[model samples]
Target: MSSGGFHVHGPHDHAVEHAAQGHGHGDDHAASHGSEGGGSSMSKIAMFTAIVATVGAIFAYMGGATQANAGLLKNDAAIKKTEASNQWNYFQSKSTKQSLAELARDLAPEDRKAAYQAKVDRYESEKNEIKVAAEKLEADSHKFDRQSEEQMHQHHRWAQATTALQVAIALAAIALLTKKKWLEYGMYGVAGIGIAVGALATLHI
Candidate 1:
């Protein structure tokens, strides 16, 4: 009787131990699955952030290029304006000489009047040529001014786009740190605005 009881008790103890080990294994597997899920989520976030960063860099470069172009145009406009002013001054000087020639012709003695009249005619013709040249320079100056203004407007658009992209990058970083879905959506929205502005800049709108 004692030998039979020991055999039965041994089998019962083995069964309980096996059950406990199985339970522990199940818990470990569940924990491992949880960790894998979390890691996958983090990997996805990192990939999205990398994509946004690349786009942001492109936007920044475009903005810089636009600003450089605007500066160049502004300088050109200023130079043209200076040239126009110089031409106008020259026009004024020619007008003064023409007036002086006319006055001299009116007051000269009758014998010398013909020579002074010839001087007056030459001065008038030169003055008309100078006026036409001065007007052309002023028109050129105005054309440059319009082009510079257009470029400046484009620069402003590019700058706005760059700013929006920067904000989106910051938001993406925040979303990664916090693991918030809503923040990620917000980041996308800002990035969309940036892309739209960049497109508009390219169109010169």
Candidate 2:
């Protein structure tokens, strides 16, 4: 014991020191546990984000495939339409030539065999005309087929672009889960570029 409102203890005061040490150790342990929990939460967030991004990428690929198939179908339809038109034109031209030949033969009767022979020659000439027209139309149809194939190819490119956009968007969303502002920002930039590409591709379609 001491004067001036101060007290001094012997060996028992060591108990106070011991209690303080235990409290401090408890506090440190609690703090460590909390820190570990926070780290685990962050890891979970990263894992979730990754899963979402992967799933989105898969869906985007599927969508791209479907869109490409649709474009191919459209091209096929266009080609068929053009082919049908050409066939109709060829039939009409052939019929017209045959009808004209019959009319010319009916107009003459005195020299019947000579007239018939002339009609045969005219029919042969008309056949040549039909053949030439059919050949030209065939060539035109082939050209159209090539154009349709090109169009389909353009559509496939568009699909790939859109798919990339979808994957980028998903990855951006995942970045947000980490609460890393910089990562999120980078993802946003990637997503924007993907969207621009998709838009350009769609325009071509």
Per residue, candidate 2 scores C-alpha lDDT tens digits across 4-104 of 98987767788988999999999999999989976775665456556546654654564566556666655665665566567657667766766776776
Off by over 4 Å in 1: 1-37
Cα error of candidate 1 at position 188, Å:
1.2
Worst 10 residues of 1 by lDDT: 1-10
TM per candidate? 0.80, 0.45
In order, candidate lDDTs are 0.81, 0.63
Per-residue lDDT of candidate 1, residues 1-205 (tens digit):
2575564447778899999999999999999998998678778767867886787688777777767877787777777778778877887887788788788878988988899888878877887887788778778777877877787788788888888878887887898789888988998899899889989988999
- Indicate which candidate wins on TM-score: 1
- Candidate 2 segments exceeding 4 Å error: 2-19, 101-205
* Residue 114, candidate 1: alpha-carbon lDDT: 92
Predicted candidate 1: what Cα RMSD to the true structure?
A: 3.5
